[model samples]
Target: MKRVFVTVGTTSFDELIERVTTPEATQALKARGYQHLVLQVGRGSILPDSDSCHELTLEVFRFKDSIAEDIKCADLVISHAGAGSCLETLGAGKPLLVVVNDQLMNNHQLELADQLYQDAHLLYCTPSTLIETLKMMDLSVLSPFLPGKPKNFADFLDKALGVQ
Candidate 1:
């Protein structure tokens, strides 16, 4: 049985949570043999009154001082497209499925998720395609996420301060 960790960063991403905890999604997840779902919802509003978590063992909370424990315990991760969440999940070598929040200004999360998917670093889906996307994947064979060398913090500092 696989454990899934869902994180939405430090802001409210109720919409993302709603999509995953929907009845359709629960059915699909159960069929896929997932046994547990742990959600780090931040300040999100949570699911609709009519929605339920189905038969799976469910653990959801508003926040955690550190998401490391939750991420480390999971077989799979479902995350918002924030860079921190995406990179952390990848660094941990966990299978990841990203859902970009289109409600953000300029659809910035969409850009991040799109680029990551293009690189084969992670799978991505929108709210409407969440269930369908999960249905199509073979998580057992997820590719390793290998990130490029990061720029030095000094480089960023210099660039930001216009100091060459």
Candidate 2:
């Protein structure tokens, strides 16, 4: 069964969870040939009612030590616009759609998501736009996010610190 994994990482984004589990969203996914929906709901107070959707199988959980396995198995990943979640999903070569949480104060998530979107690494939207994005997104256009060298950060740090 093709799966779409939705992750909020360790932070809460109940809006995203609630939006994706809606009947409309579920039907959109089903129409796209996704049979399974797995969600890591994070600290969201909302518990998904999987029984409402008969067309697709739903799996919901709060948190995990690692979501690598879920990413590996997903045909698509819908995630919050956190750097870790975004990078991990893209690194796994999964099509990623990042949902920017607009409620946060001075949100950097939007900036990151927008940059990645511009680079064709992933698609991004707000919770309000998620349904439309899901229905219309063409996953074929996303480019694989090739990871940069780990030493790049170290070199940058060294340069900033004026170390030779």
Candidate 3:
């Protein structure tokens, strides 16, 4: 059985869980025989009220130091559509399913999600389409989207500053 690591935002696990209208998607995956490890890192405004499941294990307030290692060790990653999380997952060369936060009246996450989706880099899902998206994940089709360290903004700063 393959293992899937799901990491919600660092600052709103409770809000995330409350806003997540369809947690059955996660439950369905577990029912289908996948090992699901759900971790809530940092202090999130949202969180699940309970941590009971047949195949899902939920952890709250996990250490940041261990997040990278968890990402590296997981076969697939499920996370929110924060730039930091997206970039890190891409850097790890792992396929990711990103769920953007829509309740915040923000479009940045949605924009990022669209860009990554178009780039064939990460799978993006909105709350409405989450279940279908999860069902369609074919790990065999996953390829390394982002490789190695990303360019530092400072590297471009020189050109922007016109300093040769």
Which residues of candidate 3, in runs, are more than 4 Å off? 13-23, 49-51, 105-110, 141-143, 148-164
Report the CA-based lDDT of candidate 1 relative to the real structure. 0.80
What are the RMSD figures for all models against the true structure?
4.6, 3.0, 4.3
Which window of 10 residues has the lowest lDDT sum in candidate 1? 47-56
Candidate 2 residue 52 C-alpha distance from true site, Å: 2.5
Residue 124, model 3: lDDT of 72
Question: How many clashes in each structure?
Answer: 0, 0, 11
The lDDT, on a scale of 0 to 1, for candidate 2 is: 0.90
Per-residue CA lDDT of model 2 for 1-164, tens digit only, reads 99999999887999998899888898999999999999899888988877866879999899889999999999999998888888888888899999888887477766777899999999988999999999999999988888889799999999999998
Off by over 4 Å in 2: 151-164
Best of the two (1, 2) by lDDT: 2
Better of 2 and 3 by TM-score: 2
Give the winner by TM-score: 2
**TM-score-better candidate, 1 vs 2:** 2
